[model samples]
Target: MNRLSVSRLFHLNNRKLFQALIARYSVDTGSKDYIDGLVKDDNVVVFMKGTADQPRCGFSNAVVQILNFHGVNKFSFHNVLEDESLRQGIKDYSNWPTIPQVFIGGEFIGGCDVMLEMHKNGELIEELNKVGIRSVLLDRIEEEEKK
Candidate 1:
């Protein structure tokens, strides 16, 4: 075969091999109902790349920091890196193709960029307030205003 045809054949074979491997290793993710329950079960749920204490990605770390900055220490976090199914499942479930998804009061709250925007605009404070968890930044601002 010509060089171009040989390369094309090789690429096709590689693609087939990759597909077979994926099919063999694919895992069954939790059902949509299960994901719904999990997100709603907690006031704050974060589907990130790693644990809250040790985030695997910068985006995940930013999310953890954002939550901590607001004095939100007691929240639920699922490490997507540990579960391939969860990694894909959450993206599919939220219809948001990104890691480090944040949920508040059982509502889908977008990813790191959205969180940063909310934090800057003080919208995050209001959302937290709705769930009965006050933001510490609000108290700091109030204290400064009183002085």
Candidate 2:
């Protein structure tokens, strides 16, 4: 066979393999429900590239850092890299095509950019207060004033 023919055959096989993986990893119908439970059960949840202790990507790490800076110590997190189905499923669930998705009080807060903006504008503390969690960052400031 000629080089062109062999190249065409290889491309065809690669396309077929890609389709098969897509079919296998497509979001399950119940994935939305699963994600719903996860978000609602936790006041703060992050669907990130890695676990909270060890974020795999810069975006995910930025989110972790922002939350830590705000003194948000207790929050749930899921590493989308661990599950192919979940990686895609979360995007579908949120209708937002990105990793490092954040949820506060079961509401979608958006990705790292949004979180940073909110933190910068002082909106993050208000959001946390609405969910009944005090921001340690703010709490410390208040304590200092009382001294």
Candidate 3:
């Protein structure tokens, strides 16, 4: 076969392999439902790359820091890298293509960039309150100022 034909065949095989893998991980409706439960059951949920205490990536760590800075320590987090089904299932579940996806009160908030922007402009505090979560950071800071 010619070089062009060989390359085309290789690409075709690769595409098929990718599709199969995606089907294996992405078609488990049970996993997707489980993820949905996690999102709705928690007031704050972070679908990041690692655990809350030890994030696996810089972006994930930044998200963890953002939450911690806001005094939201009781939030739920799912490490996408831990389970292949979960990693792909979350993307399908959220219809979002990235990690560090944040959910508040069962609402799909944006990723790290959105979190950073909200935190910067102080809108994050309001968002938290909308979910019945109080930002202790601001209250603590105010208390310190009065001391």
Candidate 4:
């Protein structure tokens, strides 16, 4: 084959290779439009290892606890383990390899550890306030009592 033909062949094969990999976790997503909508609806969405009530991993559990500590009881959660496609797709969707990934108002906010550090330093509260999810009033009193 001429060099030009070889280049064209490689390009075609590359395209197919890309499609095959992407297809592996591609959801009909049509029937599940709720996935995208829910992620957007909540001011804080956590794609963690499990749900808020029964977090599976230590990291996920800690994250939920941290939010609860601030009196933020409600958050959207996607359990990656429950759905094979979601498990892989979310990693790709967030462009982040780790779980317990937090999303605040349609923005990716890294993982649990990142969140914990931010919380300790008061940045988490700042961010949450920016999004209008203020920590409950009792939370303020409780935190003050601890200090």
Candidate 5:
């Protein structure tokens, strides 16, 4: 082929390839925003289906209770159902496809079932120990019963 003809063909192919990549790699801005918020609020984060006081799902309620039982007095909660973007965004953020996902110190701790298992065997205490939040059930009861 002539040089001009070859250049035209190459340009056309390049444009098509660029368009295809653009179509395939569209960014989900809403989900990205939600995930950023979740990860940033990472000291103790629970991506549950509902609020802390009134958990909307059984699994979430169990998780809240478990954390409370362990005396994790303060924590942040994201209600995934309140925003559809958050529901999907948290899965991406934690790489764990489940609600009631707990994160400690910006790391993926585990889900509700995992938390329960760990709490049962005192494994959760070890994990919390690093952040200086060990289970202090008796201590809390003595000093702070209103929590």
Candidate 6:
């Protein structure tokens, strides 16, 4: 083959190899069993746009704040922003079309608005209690009542 033909062949082969590598490394890890195991393994699981310490969106931050308010510091979090397939997969898994999905005791709890409402209605405390987590808000309220 001439030099030109050989160079073109090499470029095409490299392009194919690069695409293959991208596809291989970016395989989606958000299957039903994977998500199920993740939620089941942790009493509190948050699928949000960012990490607990640095939430990317307001709703994600709100979810993190709500959990922190209840004294839940230890929980699993998945950053959907980092994974496109997982982002879509989580929505499909919970049948909820929003980020910042909460799971308590392996049950799908709604997004930030639902969390806020539940917090206001005292249902979040109940849900946490079911997962063996005692809301610190309860203690704070009791202390205030004693005052």
Best by TM-score: 6
For 1-147, candidate 3 gives per-residue lDDT tens digits of 999999999999999999999986665533766787889988999988979988999999998899989888888888888877778888888888988899999999889999999999988999999998888878987999999
Decreasing TM-score order of the candidates: 6, 1, 2, 3, 4, 5
TM-score of each: 0.80, 0.76, 0.73, 0.70, 0.68, 0.81
| Residue 74 shift from truth in candidate 5, angstroms | 1.4
* Inter-residue clash pairs, candidate 3: none
- Local accuracy of candidate 5 as per-residue lDDT tens digits, 21-122: 997456452475646666557578888988998899999999999888888858998898877766877787667888988888777889988998988887
10 residues in a row with least lDDT, candidate 6: 24-33
* Top candidate, metric lDDT: 6
Which ten contiguous residues of candidate 5 have the minimum total lDDT?
24-33
Q: Is candidate 1 or candidate 3 better by TM-score?
A: 1
Q: Write the residue-wise lDDT of candidate 1 on 81-124 in tens digits.
A: 98887888898899999999999999999899999999999999
lDDT of 2 by residue, 1-147 (tens): 999999999999999999999986674633887789888988999999989999999999999999999888789998999887789888999999999999999999999999999999999999999999888889788989999
> What Cα-based lDDT does every candidate model obtain?
0.91, 0.90, 0.87, 0.80, 0.80, 0.93
Prediction RMSDs, each to the true structure: 12.9, 11.5, 12.7, 13.2, 11.5, 8.0
For TM-score, candidate 4 versus 6, the one ahead is 6
lDDT measured at residue 47 in model 2 versus the true structure, 0 to 100: 93
lDDT of 4 at 71: 80
Q: Can you list the residue pairs that collide in candidate 4?
A: none
Across residues 1-147, which tens digit of lDDT does each residue of candidate 6 receive? 999999999999999999999986765657787788878979999999989999999999999999999999999999999888889889999999999999999999899999999999999999999989999999999999999
User: How close to the true structure is residue 147 of candidate 6, measured as C-alpha lDDT?
Assistant: 100
- Whichever of 2 and 5 has more TM-score, that candidate is 2
Q: What TM-score does candidate 1 reach?
A: 0.80
lDDT of 2 at 34: 79
